[model samples]
Target: MSATVFAGALFAGPVLAGPLRANANDVPLADIPALVLPALGETLIMVGIVMAVVVVVGVPLGAIIHNLARDGLFPNPSLHSALSWIVSVGRSLPFLILMVAIIPFTRLLTGTNIGIAAAVVPMSVAGIAFFTRIVENSLRSVPPSLVKVAKSSGGSSFQIIRTAQLGEAVPSLIGGLTINTIAMIEYSAIAGTIGAGGIGYVAITYGYQRFDNQVMLATIIILVALVAAVQVIGDALVRLTTPHSSTASDRRFARKVARLDIESANAASPV
Candidate 1:
C-alpha cells in the first residue's frame, strides 16, 4: 500500500507535465513575464479582498454563534437553529453553481460579471460563510472550565471573550486564516474560467487553447512559488506568537495554591 501510494505520487507529476509541455516551443518567451505578473496581481487582489471581508464579517458572526449556549446572551434555540441552517445552506452550495448563480448580482455591482471584479463578489461571499465556521470552531475550543473561571471572577460575556477566550484561541485562529488564504488562491484559479485574470486564466488561454505549453509550465512554477511563500510566512508568524514551551505560569499558580493547602493541613493536624 505504501509503495503504491508512493508510486502514484511519483508518476502524477510526470503525467501532468507531459501534456503541458507537448507544444512548449510555440509560446513567445518575451510574453511570459507580462502574463505572469498581471495574473499574480489579479490573484492577490481577489484573495486580499476576500480575506478582508472574511475577517470583518466572519469573526463577529462566529463570536455571536459561540455565545449561543444555554448560558449565552439571547440563548434561544430557535434563533440558533435558524442561523445555523442559514450558514449550513450557504456552505452547502457548490462553488461553481454559486458563482454562476450570483452572476446577475455580481454584474450589477461590478458592472461586468465576467471579470476579476465580478469574481471577487462570489469569492468574498463564499469566504465569509466558509471562514465563519472555522472561526466559530476555534472560539468554541475555549474550554468551558476556563469560561466558568472567568465568570466566577465577575467577568461579563464580552470581557471573558475579549480577555480569555480570544486570547487563548489566537494561535488557532491565525492558523485557520493561513489555511483559508491558501484556499482563496485555489479558488482564484477556478474562477479563471469565468474571465478572472490570474495564473489560471493564463493557463487556459495560452496552455490549453493556444497550445503554448511553455506558458502553462511557467505559470505552474509561479503558482508553486506563490504558495510556498505564503506557507513560509504563515509558519514564521505562528511560531512567533505561540508561548514559549519553558513558560509555566499556569503550573506555578497551581503549585502555589497546592502548597498553601498543604501548610493549612499541617497546622490543623492533631498534635
Candidate 2:
C-alpha cells in the first residue's frame, strides 16, 4: 500500500503543478530577449563608470603608495604606511556590507540612495581600493634595474614612473584591471538588492519572488556569457602587450653573437 501511494504521488506531482503553469504572466521564453537587454545595458553602464573612476583615481593612488614605500622611488615610509593602512581597511570590508555602510555617502554623491547613479559611488569606492592594490603590486614587480637606468639618465621621479615602471608593468596591470572589472560586475548584481536595477533585480523579482524558474535560468546564462566575454577580451589585451619570450631570446642571442664578433675583430687588431 505504501509503495502504491508513493507511485501515485510521483505521477500526480506534474499534473498537480500544471495549474500553477497556467498563469500566463510567468516568464515566457519569447520575452527573455527584451527583458535581458535592458539589464545588460544597465550593467554595462554601471561597470563602465566604475572602471573609468578606478583607472583615473586608483592607478595614481596606487602608484603614489608604491613610490612612497621603502626602497621606492621616493621612499616616504610615513605616507606609505598610512595609505597602505587605509587601503587595507577598505579592502578588508565585504563589498555588500560596504555598500550598505556607504549609503549616506552614496546619497550625498548622487542625491538618491537608489538606481545606477547611486550604485556607482560605492562600487567605485570599492573598486578603487581593490585596483589600487593591484596597481601597487604591478608597479612593485617592475625590474629595479629599469628604474636605476632611468635615474642614471637624470629622469625625474614622475618620468621614471611613466617611462619605466608603468611601461614595463602594462601586461600585469591589464590583468589586474580584468579581475577588478569582474569583481565590480558581482558587486553591481548585489546592488540590485537596494533597488538598483539590473539582471540581479530581474532574477530576484521574476525568478525568486514570482517563482519563474525560466527567468532565473536565463539570467544565469546571460551573466556567465558576460563574464566569459570580459575574461577573453582582457586576456587578449594582455597577450598583445606582453613580449614574446622566444623572440626576445632570439634577439638576445643575436646581440651576443654580434658583440663576440666585434671583440674578436678588435683583439685581432693592434689595439
| True lDDT of residue 184, candidate 2 | 92
State how far residue 184 of model 2 sits from its true place (Å).
0.8
lDDT of each: 0.78, 0.86
TM-score of 1: 0.77
Q: List the residue pairs that clash in candidate 2.
A: none
List, residue by residue over 167-197, the lDDT tens digit for candidate 2.
8999999999999999998998888888788
Residue 115 of model 1 has an lDDT of 75
**In angstroms, what RMSD does candidate 1 have relative to the true structure?**
7.6
* Model 2 TM-score (2 dp): 0.83
lDDT of 2 at 207: 74
Could you tell me every candidate's TM-score relative to the true structure?
0.77, 0.83
lDDT of 1: 0.78
